[model samples]
Target: MISRIVRWAAQLVILAGIAAFIGALSVAPAFTYRPADMAFIRINFTHGAPRAECWRPTQAELTKLPPSQRRPNDCPRERPAIVLRFELDGVVLLDESLPPSGLSRDSPSPIYRGFSVAPGPHRLHLAMRDNPRTKEYDYTSDFDVMLSPQQNLVIGFDPRSGGFRIR
Candidate 1:
């Protein structure tokens, strides 16, 4: 009688502990993704330019080819790979060479990345070169930023606006 009651009470405690352990496991990832006292900076953009080696055919060159062989001046559907660089407080953080997107490499390459940093003021340097001919970056931006804990700063490009923008 007394033994039966003790055994049931012990089984109930064990079952409750198992349930609590599973619940904690489910919530652990959520907390890790948004830890306290850290700010995140997001950089995302889609940019590409025509490959420098792809050239337009002159009239003489065009006439020598068949009608099917002759294409428009800008008919090349491929673009050059893009080079990206990011610096924080004069230290290099991210440097990547991204290939163009699309089934045929005709579309703009997209980049989406994030960096975690302590909340404070820092100098940021960003540069990107979509063109392959020149060794210089087509777009460069440098500025000082102040960030708060748990904040997110997003940077992206606007083609119509003709430059990178931050928000």
Candidate 2:
């Protein structure tokens, strides 16, 4: 009877070990899992103008405007000479290239585009190019953004008087 009980206990232990091994395998894939709803941010310049030519603004031009006249916070009193296309997740989502020529003081129309995201933790980084005319300036801005599930996100560029603002 003693030998028989010991054998039964050993068998139980082996079965429990197998169950644990299978459970670990099933959970392992979740650790490396990335959601399928990932999206990318893109910029499209209107009229095929080079990014450099379209976004370059002289310091003198920026200084002439009142603080509130700048972009991201204020729509251009005059429509931008250039149009910018913004997209998310590879779709042609926003076409802001042909905005109306005039805007009121309070209308800070967003010039940047945004994308919807699923719930999960995310990271965003800004990428830009400096205009030779204004070494301190970025003529084009790129962003690498990540989002978690059920997260609602909006991303856009504001040419704040030729400076880049991402929100």
Candidate 3:
């Protein structure tokens, strides 16, 4: 009888250990965490523009199309590449030219990048040019920020707002 009790206790303890192991595996890590002395900035954006040269369909071409298919302008399927620039305190940190959409280059090109920096006050500058032919950027943003240790700064763009957003 005593041996049976010992056997039951041993089984209970083993079951408890298995349950604890599974529970540990199921638990998630802390929502926010960072290693010693580190901070980062993340930028995500998507934008595109049609080719600069667009024209109305020729009368013969329009006639071939169904009445519902006719449109004022018929733009080429290809789009221009996007130029992205990021600066930190007047120093250029990232300068990249991203190709437009996909095989046809008719979709929006997306941009996602991350940069690591020391935790302190700094100036940030960002610019984007969708038109490869133009020297000037279509959108620009500049700001001064104070960063804390283990902090993450996010930047994005909104076409409707016509500017970059920082958070």
Point to the candidate with the largest lDDT: 3
Residues 1-167 of candidate 3 have per-residue lDDT tens digits of: 99999999999999999999888878855454555487789988788865768798888999999999898798677887888899998999889988876877777888889888889999999998887778999989998999888889998888788778888
lDDT of 3 at 143: 83
Each candidate's lDDT (Cα)?
0.85, 0.45, 0.85
Highest TM-score model number:
3
The alpha-carbon lDDT assigned to residue 62 of candidate 1 equals 90
| C-alpha TM-scores of all predictions | 0.72, 0.30, 0.74
- The clash numbers for all candidates, in the given order, read 0, 10, 0
Q: Write the per-residue lDDT of candidate 1 for residues 1-167, one digit (tens) a residue.
A: 99999999999999999999999898776646665799988998888765656578888899999989887573566887888899999999988889999998878889999999999998889888877888998888887899999999998987568667788
Q: What are the runs in model 1 whose C-alpha is more than 4 Å off?
A: 1-30, 51-67, 70-74
Writing each residue's lDDT as its tens digit, candidate 2 over 39-90 gives 3333322221122223444667777888765443332233223344343444
The candidate 1 region of ten consecutive residues with least summed lDDT is 27-36
Q: What residue pairs clash in candidate 1, if any at all?
A: none
Estimate the Cα RMSD of every predicted model relative to the unseen true structure.
3.7, 15.6, 4.4
